[model samples]
Target: MLIILILPLLKANHPDFMNMATKAVKRAFLVALIPLLLFLSESTTGFIHKLPWFDIFLTSLDMSYKLDIFPTVFLPVALFVTWNILEYSLWYMAQDPNQQKFIKYLLIFLLTMIILVTSGNLITLFLGWEGVGIMSFLLISWYFSRNDAVVAAMQAVLYNRIGDIGFLMAFCWLISYSGSISLDFALATTAKSTTLPLVGFILAAASKSAQFGLHPWLASAMEGPTPVSALLHSSTMVVAGIYLLIRTQPLLGLNDTALTTCLCLGAISTAFAATAALTQNDIKKIVAYSTSSQLGLMMVAIGLNLPHLAMFHICTHAFFKAMLFMCSGIIIHSLNDEQDIRKMGGLQHHLPLTTTCVSIGSLALMGTPFLAGFYSKDAIIEAMNTSYVNFTALLLTLIAVSFTAVYSLRLMYFTSLKYPRHNVIINFDELSTPVFKTITRLCLGSIFAGWLILHFFLPSNDITHTMPPHIKMTALLITLLAFIIAFDLAKFHWTKEPKNKITSKQFSTNFYPIIIHRSVTTLTMNFSWNLTSHILDLLLLKALMPDLLKITQLPPMLMVRLSQSGLIKLYISALLITLFLAMIPTILL
Candidate 1:
């Protein structure tokens, strides 16, 4: 079935039937995914578990017993399979060749996700993870022919690899500390140990999620194509980190040290990224920064040991964020790829559908009442306030939530409400670019409340064990304040207009960006590292090189003395002690 769908993709560029190729791919996708659909059909009203299909993979590999098939494996795979069917539909309708390539990669990645989600063990999960990473690199560099795309892809891959180091470190630590790295044994050993794994797990999560020091790359990732942004901003991209954290959560400690670190990192990242978003000029970059901030908020929930709420926010935020990015893409496409929201205005008249969808998406982003974001995001704030005794974390999170409103509403106001700060030169070609339409519609769909599945499905009174009234009011009030601010911005935008066109004065536009571009800011920020490295490299290392050579010049005479001393048993006791210590772990295990 999968092969049938892939055939069209392989022949999408064929001369005679390019039109038929997309349909063929769609058919192949449906055929390939039927098994997954059938598997997910089983009802699991009580818990997130099911009979294990991974046993087949295990049996095929000639493995023994202990294959536990349950919901964790099935649910993610089900979601992937479901998303692929949707992607196939969207891709079949997307006419652009570049869009086809994007679709092709997306299909392959979804297949890989299926493998990862259903994997019976860590090995299987890692396999899918690397595939996801590789696909992300490829899709992110979708505009590889462009210089900035190449750079953005590079930054993303490099940053992820840094996180991978922590993953690898934890993997090795597991192997050394415990006999096996399997989840079951690791869980047992984690309880026995002083909880070293928890700290390592955190290092792994922080880097992967683009939290704190790992964050700048996520901001730079906006250089990629827009759909790529939507994917990166939502769904599998950033959420994988949180998923890993949640999965390994059993091993992680809830001690004061662990909680404090999580809270501090989450707060700093939440507040810092919000400030960063405040300065961004590009519409997508602002959203990208928001992604960072939102992810930080998710981390805060996770640190508070509120994985359920984090997961809840993850699902809802994914829908709304993807929606905003796709809408931004449409607006850019409508304006001939002019992404500066400042330059756009009065699009409401020209793009009625987009105006409505983008506004609601922004509303959802701001967590307006009755919207999916309202339920999920406010749930996180409520969880935070309820879980943490320290008021600092909750206070900071509320402040961060306010900023989300500010940036989100600001995004809508600048791009959708006015005639554009700069003149738009491109003609709208909605029929030619249906992929953008698909993504936009998907985003708008979230505003209506489909995303409340998590909140609705979980056992009633599980957390409150009651769904507090404050959740509704908090989200409503926060969203209203944000919307009011946005409305005021729109009113101001309505009253003001740029006098001259962008093309009319080239230097006029280039001058402001040149002065404000992050290059100057970066150099200042890295000044200490630069100064320290200069002295270390030029003065200390270079000067020490000759002195070290002079000391080693007398090695001929010293060699005989050293060899004679080694023969002497003066340090025999020390060597025995060192060997004994090293052998202790092997003996213990």
Candidate 2:
């Protein structure tokens, strides 16, 4: 772990060191990751060696420590994060001129991945947790030369920190309430009590996960690179929030109020993001909001006490959302970084593979039949039918269901569909455009992989056996309705509809709930940002360059004050006399 972490930093700062040192450092980071990979691979293959066909995957599970569940969340994420690190390192080392500018981002990226997946306790989680916040700040400032990038990156960090503070409080509360930060210990304790710390834990989980008010930051995060968006949406920033909820599921039984709040917030965030996404002109932003909204739905799934369904949705969402982000990246690259979907069209012929992958991703997003998203999205809403609380959740999910369709298709249409305009220029001048197609294949593989796992092997877990089929059927029906809505939207002529103009009031009408989330965000910006630095400056009261002149050449009032040294002698005499008097009194006593 130490070497794995160090190599990235060395590579990042390589230029400052000697020439040979740079090569050695770069090689060092790569070599370190290799050992971990070999060990894990050997262990897995050895354990599963005797099992037939597909049972081999299950055979490997026995090797893992029981404190940490294997193949479920941690191991997969760790392997993936390591892959991200190696990819980042290679990209950075290649010094592709264009990529060189963002090389320093490698360290932050890999560190975040390591800290998160290997986190054994809440504190460790926070370490990986906050690493993301810091890395986000750095990457956001990647194009620091741009005023937009700097401000946007700062906004991303500031907003996420507000959520991080909640995580910190929850971590502290966990230690106080449960006597340990271990996920098992805390869950065990939570399974026993109805207490305030449980409430704190819930708020922390909800806020960090982008529940309701904390949701806007995810949309703004599109200001960073598309790869960042893919990772962020898939397994890092956004996932951290949901992971906390899953990790703390044991304590959830202790407080119904906390769970209800999470449920309401999740519902509101989903509806809010979906509505907001519908009005977005920026393709990435539309997808960004959609990711947040989808995450909100997953939160609700967990809140409704359906974690297996939530986990299923999380897996499928990861597939489609990552594909969507990567595809959006391709479209943006093809159009010379033009993110406005309105400015994009006819890219289906230009980037056919990317277009195809995005279409599959979109189908998955809409929960169309036979797709990865279909099975999971259906299960969650269907599972909602089992109880009163769940029934309300089911209703909200259905009403909001079509919003996914509306925005998901709207996103694909503007970017890939043929919308004729008087003067439009589409540029495909970059290699990343084709490289993005490969990413799409990767995404499709993930989506298809899920279907294979579920259809053939049957997704095994603690709860799949007990779940009712009708509930799954109900979810499937809602998903089907959503797909129909997306298809209908796709058939419409959006370009011919008047001005091609989007309005603040109109967009806000759609985005109002999520945007209102911005007010607290605005107030927070003032405190952490505007008012905060102001307060810090007041505290520091440092001398500036201008003050150097003032000190050398005093103002008239200061000259007069300098001349008045008469009080200095008088003060010294008084001190001496007081000391003498005290000494005499002590001597006499």
Candidate 3:
């Protein structure tokens, strides 16, 4: 079945029948994936006691290369990937000449993520980790002609490489202490031995997941195609860090420092990103910052020692996040690539379906009641309230949640409710059949996947269902308050200049993490170059070379002057010296 899905991709470059064939292939693949998902879910339930759904082993240097799939994590990821692939085939890239190449890159990206998530050993995990990094660099730079795309791709690679160092450090510690890189072996070690690796793992998660200090790349990643944004943000690349920490939850549980670190990093990132999202005008960037905020919450869940909650949130976030990006894609496409929300208004009058889907996604994002986000997000917040972790983290998380509602509603108000501000008069309606089907399917998931996953897969005991009514109602109440505040704020026309221009610009610029990062890097490079030039180039090479050369050339200069002089005695003396030196070797022999 997988082979059938991939065969059409190989011939996707043939212009004669490529379009229809690829579309049909994508639909067929989606159809085929349904039964497979159902079968996996049923088997997982029936054989819940059985460990590791599937495994592969290959022997090299007496080490086993193993792959294992845990249904709870892999199922939601598979579903999201399937939907993303279908959406990629829609009208978004229908006119691009390199559509086939883009599709291939997306498939390869998905395959690498699957490998990473299902990896049973550290070596396999590293391979998958590097694979995704490389593929992301390629996909994010898909529009190679654009300077922003190229820069975004480079930024992603450099940031992820920093995380890769952590992964490598962790692997080295595992190999040295445990004599094996297998997850099972690493887990069996003493806490003292695992603490350093856990620290490394946290660093890896921070970099890949875009924690507070390491998050500028995610916002810049909007330079890519929207489908890339959807898949990259939703399930595959950004979440890999959180997934790693979740996979190592048992190890994380044994360490206090690591958990505290996760808590601080997550809390800071969530609050920072949510605040940044509120002041953004670009449609895609608003969603991108929201993704960073959600990932931060996932980290918070990990810190609270509730990996199950984090995993549950990952599953739920994937659906609506992807839907949100696709909806944004449709809007931007319809507007001939206009991305500023200030220029977009009253979309509901023209593209009602797209507007409705975007609203659903935003609501899910803000943790509305019974939606996909509410199930997981509310649980995480509840856990935060009940846990004995940092007080500051809890406060930041709650504030970030309220900020989430504010930004989400604010986004909808400017794009859907206000009078049309865009100059384009084109009638933007529902796109093709594939677009409709993809959006509808994701909308359903955004509504129900969270509840389904929570009820079926996640342990109910972990959720603090018996909390006080005030605590239980905190997220809902905060969301409602935020909606009211945001509505009031929305009444003002966006065209009017803000009174606090500098503050507004700072928030819109993501608090200038990108600026700080570039400034630091530039200063460091300039300092190093200056030091090298002064010490090595000027002092050693330039200052000493003339004297050394003059000293070395003195004998040659004297010989040449003597030869050029109109003096037979000098020539005879030089000839006698040469003959004497030449005869010395013969005499010694």
Writing each residue's lDDT as its tens digit, candidate 1 over 1-589 gives 3354456566656653434444554454455344434434643332222233343422322111221222333243234323533442354325556565565666565556555444444555566667777887887777678888888788778778877777777766776666553655666665444446667667767766788777766766787766567766766667777777766655554455666777778877787777667656688888887888888888887777776667667767776777677767777767867877777877877776776777887777767777777776777777665664467766677777777777776776777664556555546754445554555546544765435355333522346556557653664676567667756765775356657556535523233334544676688779978999999988789768876676777787786666566654657866888899999999999
For model 3, give the RMSD to the true fold. Answer: 6.2
Q: How accurate is candidate 2 locally (lDDT)?
A: 0.62
What is the alpha-carbon lDDT for the whole of candidate 1? Answer: 0.64
Candidate 2 local lDDT, 1-589, one digit each (tens): 4354455455554554223332333454355445435544543321111111222432221111122332233334333433433343342234345454354454455556555645555656667777877887777666678787787777677667676676766777666677655556666765454656556555665555666665655666677777667767765667666766766777774567767877777887787777777778888888788787888888888777766566666656766676677677767655666778777777777777778877788778877777877777766665566556845655666766778877777777777788532135555532353354345445554567457435422223444446556665665566567666666766765655655455545646335434565676787787789776775565445345455567777777686776566888866887899899889978998
- lDDT scores of the candidates, listed in order: 0.64, 0.62, 0.80
| lDDT for position 395 in model 3 | 91
lDDT of 3 at 47: 23
TM-score of 2: 0.72
* Residue 448 displacement (Å), model 3: 1.1
**RMSD in angstroms between candidate 2 and the native structure over all alpha carbons:** 11.2
lDDT of 3 by residue, 1-589 (tens): 3354466666666663445444544564465455446645664431211123333454222223332234334544554555555455546788998776776777667667766776667776887788888998998999999999999999988888888888899888877777655776676774643578888888888888988877888998899998899889888899999989987877887788888999989999999999889878899999999999999999999999888788888888999998999889888888888999888999898888888998999999999999999999998998888879899999999999999999999789878986898865865557668788788888998998887776655462445559899988998999899888887777764547778776755446554765788798999999999999899877799768976788788989997776798889887998999999999999999
TM-score per model over all chains = 0.72, 0.72, 0.84
Best by lDDT: 3
Over 4 Å off, model 2 = 1-9, 13-67, 70-74, 77-104, 419-437, 452-472, 490-493, 499-504, 507-589
Hey, what RMSD does candidate 1 come out at? 12.1
